[model samples]
Target: MTDSTRPTALVTGSAGFIGMHVCERLLADGYRVVGIDSMSDYYDVALKEARHARLARSNGFTAEVGRIEEPERLMRLFEANTPDLVVHLAAQAGVRYSIENPRSYVEANLQGTFELLEAARAHPPEHMLLASTSSAYGASTEMPYRETMKADTQMSFYAATKKATEAMAHSYAHLYGLPISMFRFFTVYGPWGRPDMALFKFTRAILTGEPIDIYNHGEMSRDFTYIDDLVEGIRRLADAVPERPEGGVVPEGDSLSPVAPFRVVNIGNGAPVPLMEFVRAVEAATGREAEKRYLDMQPGDVPATWADTSLLNALTGYAPTTPVEEGVGRFVDWYRGYYAV
Candidate 1:
């Protein structure tokens, strides 16, 4: 704790790609940040460690290593710290991986969130923001996904688990009067991104003279959001705490739950760029033409994703604006510097 006067933020998955950036932003904003991460080997553990190492340089940051699903892990944290703001970003990520290992999804996304919500119920925060996914909009052919839209058709187990957590949070909010926001994120990318993501994999393959997989035969599109942009959204939304509507009269177009102090907002770039276009941007950034191997779309994968960010703008007066080309260029630069390529 740097100072008792400063606000405290407990951030789960603090060493993850998005989590690291969020923790850094909160620390920069002068908040005392307590971060918890399991350091799961799903991706490169070294990358996760490096993210935490950077945060350790900040005197305001306190790092904790443990699984969120572990019994009493989050409860002990809440008991000791009593955080003012809680950001739940920890989970088992990846749609394809979830198919191979559905149990991980159940443990991390489902059980882990149960533990978090229970802890929050014990020591309620001013605001709690949990990360959901655009994949929650599964099977919808709508051009741009919205927060108020019916998102019951989650295509993958990963998405299903994420949606389940949103429901779980809502129930807690209703029961305990906890202020909660569920953020439905689109395709996030940029510097310090995950190795499993397309931007990272494409950049790595292109630089190493290897072929990149072009799923759905380059017929895909994603609202590729930049890392900085996403972090800014999270920071802004932290202050936009939800309040249960009076008399159960919710405003039109608002996803705020009438029964609870809860809402779901879309955090995305708002522009869906085609797969070939994204690859071209990578090539431009890396100065290497990628060898492409066209393949059918993976199971549980959608061909396109677009976000409707009106609710986010309405609430926080901000939306993600980074273009894929610029975001991809920054990521390639970071990748080269990070790997010494």
Candidate 2:
């Protein structure tokens, strides 16, 4: 039953790392949340199930298990929920995985997004937020990537698909006057993160007395945004809906479309930390030194990613700034408790 007093948010990929956190935050804010996740075996299904279990404890949360790419799946969900807000976080993630299975990216990231757009077209939401990636600024060596910059050189198929979705969403926003905000997240880490992600992998290897691979020969850097900080940015951005600029005049450093109620915002810690320092943070948190095996850079990977979050600040009055050490420590605590290590 729909709660007339509270707004409903339909969040796809709700059992995933970021999706789970976003659903919790929305529910905490007194919104009825409808969460959907396919529970694909990209990582540990047990972990994803645990996340869903936590969300299920909340009475305001409703969970649906299914793939978004299925025909009429999203349309049925939209028609049933009539959600006022939509957060499209479901997609085939991982750069190396995309290299191994390009078709998954096509089906989930591209085709899945198409379905979401179609559903939103049929039943318009008050606002829609789509997840993009820092990889979308692929092959662009420009430090502190601004949203207004051209993102034409996607080095990886994963990045290319994400960039394509931005275009797809923009067209929908322009044609249907749908308010859309695309958030380009940096390297996000914290408790309950995906096992494939660096923080979780490193923590597990370190605790189990195994060597951790340091790609790019420990030369790479990343704007490591904490999960809480990233979630806070998304929560604030939900209310800071973009509008089409008047007379095609967008403010300086803004990525707002002049022809549509849409914009791309970078949600990242403005500071890029070295990979070695991040490993050290993990070591500190776990109280164990990692046997670092430095190696050459992997294909379809950038040496570094930095975000220029001034536009995000201007719009939402907030930006992710969590220090790596503190965030890593929090993750380590959760890992030890959860894994009984």
Candidate 3:
């Protein structure tokens, strides 16, 4: 594959903040990227090694720090980049660290999404994106949240290992036809984020004056979705591929998969903000003043989340609508210029 090398796209979690903005928008859309990551001290492994040292200085970006539950290192990274398209977004994300390490969410969200759906069921990747959330609508008192919503009650062991890796990627996209697309992200924040979420821990405890915890007393509500509008609605949903629904009769705010080529959209910002106006946009983006400390909503939390991105704008014509006070003032100016404090 070398007509001056530019046809790859394997991004598993490229030192992740939405997989480093979806491998910097697939290297600004020219593609050549292989990224796969495992720098998981769970957080700030030196900001995931400075976002894999700025995408390994982009000689068409190549990276590989293992662990997709090691199906021989994701089948040796799908036999060394035979990738046409596969963006699994490496798992084990948090929800109170899956109620205190429930086997690190059953070995990274159910055996690492069943070893990236068995390396896209032995290399059949033309379009396979799978990062799901909105806490898989557990305990649903639904208001907004759609993508065929009926995600049985998954209150948490990290949303039941992301709803058991969306029912093991809809039985490997209905027994290996494989064209999956399970996105469901919601409270995605911004600017190299994730030191355990809540707007990067309430903007690093409201710029270090320290206290912030809040929780249920702040009374949740999220659907935030920003990281450049969730990597531009996941690069327009890596091209909307999910067909198999021609009747199994499952409608009413849908969760699509009558039998799979799999589908589940909702990239959210379909409005839901209040957690005290998202800590008043990180206390007005770091002018400071948090010290909150409320608590008591633990044990797999859930107070609210909203997203009905109309089947991700009817399958990616586009829609993630960011604006949490300009995405919390671009994560408070990249957390005061990357922790210079």
After TM-score superposition, what is the CA distance of residue 209 in candidate 1 from its true location, in Å? Answer: 0.4
Candidate 2 RMSD to the correct structure: 1.1
Model 2 residue 267 distance off true place after TM-score fit, in angstroms: 0.2
* Order of the predicted models by TM-score, top scorer first: 1, 2, 3
Model 3, runs deviating above 4 Å: 1-9, 12-16, 21-49, 54-85, 88-122, 125-127, 130-145, 149-176, 184-187, 191-222, 225-253, 267-271, 274-279, 288-305, 308-334, 337-341
Question: Can you write out model 1's per-residue Cα lDDT over 47-126, one digit (the tens) per residue?
Answer: 99999999999979998999999989999999999999999999999999999999989999999999999999999999
lDDT of 2 at 9: 98
lDDT of each residue in 1-341, candidate 3, tens digit only: 45257778898878988898889888888888888788989787889889889888876888878788876788778787778888888888888777777897788778988888887788887888889888888888968867665778888778778878878888888998898888878878888888888788888877778898887898788878888888888788787676776676655555667887777787877988888988887788788778888978888778998887877776667876668999889888988898888
Question: Lowest summed lDDT over 10 consecutive residues: which window, candidate 2?
Answer: 1-10
Task: List RMSD in Å for every model shown.
Answer: 0.9, 1.1, 16.4
Report the lDDT tens digits of candidate 2 across residue range 1-341.
Answer: 44777899999999999999999999999899999999999999999999999999997899899999999999999999899999999999999999999999999999999999999999999999999999999999989899989999998999999999999999999999999999999999998999999999999999999999999889999999999999999999999988888899988788999999999999999999999999999988888889989898999999999999898889989977678999999999999999999
Per-candidate total of colliding backbone pairs: 0, 0, 5
Which pairs clash inside model 3?
Answer: 147-254, 148-253, 148-254, 148-255, 149-254
lDDT of 2 at 86: 94
Candidate 3, overall lDDT?
0.81
